[model samples]
Target: MTVHDIRAALAADKATVGTWLQLPSPDVAELMARAGYDWVAVDMEHGSFGRTGLPDIFRAIECGGAAPFARLPVAAKTTVKAALEAGAQGLIFPMIETREQLNQAISWAVYPGHDDGRAPDEPLRENRGVGYCRANVFGKDFDAYMTRRAPELFLVAQIEHIRAVENLDAILSHPRLDAIMVGPYDLSGSMGLTAQFDHPDFKAAMERIHAACKRHKPLMGLHIVQPDPEELRRQIAAGSRFIAYGIDSVFLWRGAERPR
Candidate 1:
């Protein structure tokens, strides 16, 4: 499906399950995409691969008919532009702690004239660069891509710090923010409580973040990193709309460790 489909599903508040890709291999990408995921996100923030491998991995994921998404290491125009041009249907910006950063992210993902999530009366803040690339079929469909694809690209913000949690409501208020994914590990680290998911302070921070979702419009997402189906279901039942199952490495390790 396309970004439009993902947006519609989020609007409908439906559970859209996806898995993470950290390996640089296109074969793994294709296999995961064909394994019943609605989408598959390439983990640039922590993955070993770089920009050079993105296109083939995206193509591989697309071969299995799943939307290819990406998690950016940092929000930079050059990288963002390249990722979108390489056919990323969606993007997740990590370490976002302020509304300003989010607005800049919107600018990077969207073109120069469209107000994807801006107020009707507000001025357009289009900041995406235009050029012939894979997304527009090397400019053959540039006009159509600019008019449609550029404006409809999915953009997600990852709240992974105490400051982001404190600013949650304001962060979620952005119209251009398609969804918010909680980076639990980083979040706990920011709170001086790394990996202590059960600590009161950590739980409190999570509670505040989740609470903000009930008061906002963007879809809420969380990662079920351990490959536990029951835990994945529990989060969805508790109100996660955009859910990421497990990273490719974990899945591979678990399968290999399973008794024959």
Candidate 2:
């Protein structure tokens, strides 16, 4: 039960770039960990990985030294609880639109009985990371488990709506928010230009997000398909810290698209 310091690692210039593993199998997660990613998100928002398949993926991420984060379908309490209990070290809620939703998202992420306002160095939050029965009953020491698992389970929110952009200040100012990710597709749609990455409105939205993020200091992420190395470098230069490079199906479709 050892946890990887993903935030510190990211701060130390360790490229935490990872792909979205939409597949149900743990093998993909294991493979990505072996590839030395900082973390991998099990895409429950779009992937077919329901309750049963997600646990194995989370375990695989731990075994690989890559953090396990789940992109829940929404910022619902039950969904977040179930994912965390299943051993997901972090969460990413999709289609976020308001500050109220962000606060609600943190409410679901933290332990139910404990107060959420603890000093950073305190162990209140750490004590509440009671893992699932499988991990707990397996005779894994809880403290060791937490030392390895608790602190790293980041609560990330995806900001995609133009309304969210309008309320960016309030959203980013929430104390519990650990990171913010951009849903480029939904964002483009929000801008009235679906899937057009080159659209002026889309670029403007990205800039606004980047600019607003500077004020809050949470990890900022962008979603890209078939991302190039140079583009990754450029984003890092622009102050983006979290990144999702590709998804499970993209690997398959891109492989199929290879020029033979």
Question: Could you tell me how far off, in angstroms, the CA of residue 61 lies in candidate 2 after the best superposition?
Answer: 2.2
lDDT against the true structure, per candidate, is 0.86, 0.74
RMSD of each: 2.0, 4.1
- TM-scores of the models, in the order given: 0.94, 0.86
Give the winner by TM-score.
1
lDDT of 2 at 107: 65
Residues 72-129 of candidate 2 have per-residue lDDT tens digits of 9877877887787787777888877877677666766665454454435534322243
**Which candidate gets the maximum lDDT versus the true structure?**
1
Position 122, candidate 2: lDDT: 36
lDDT of 1 by residue, 73-129 (tens): 888887787689899999999999988778877788877667756655555565887
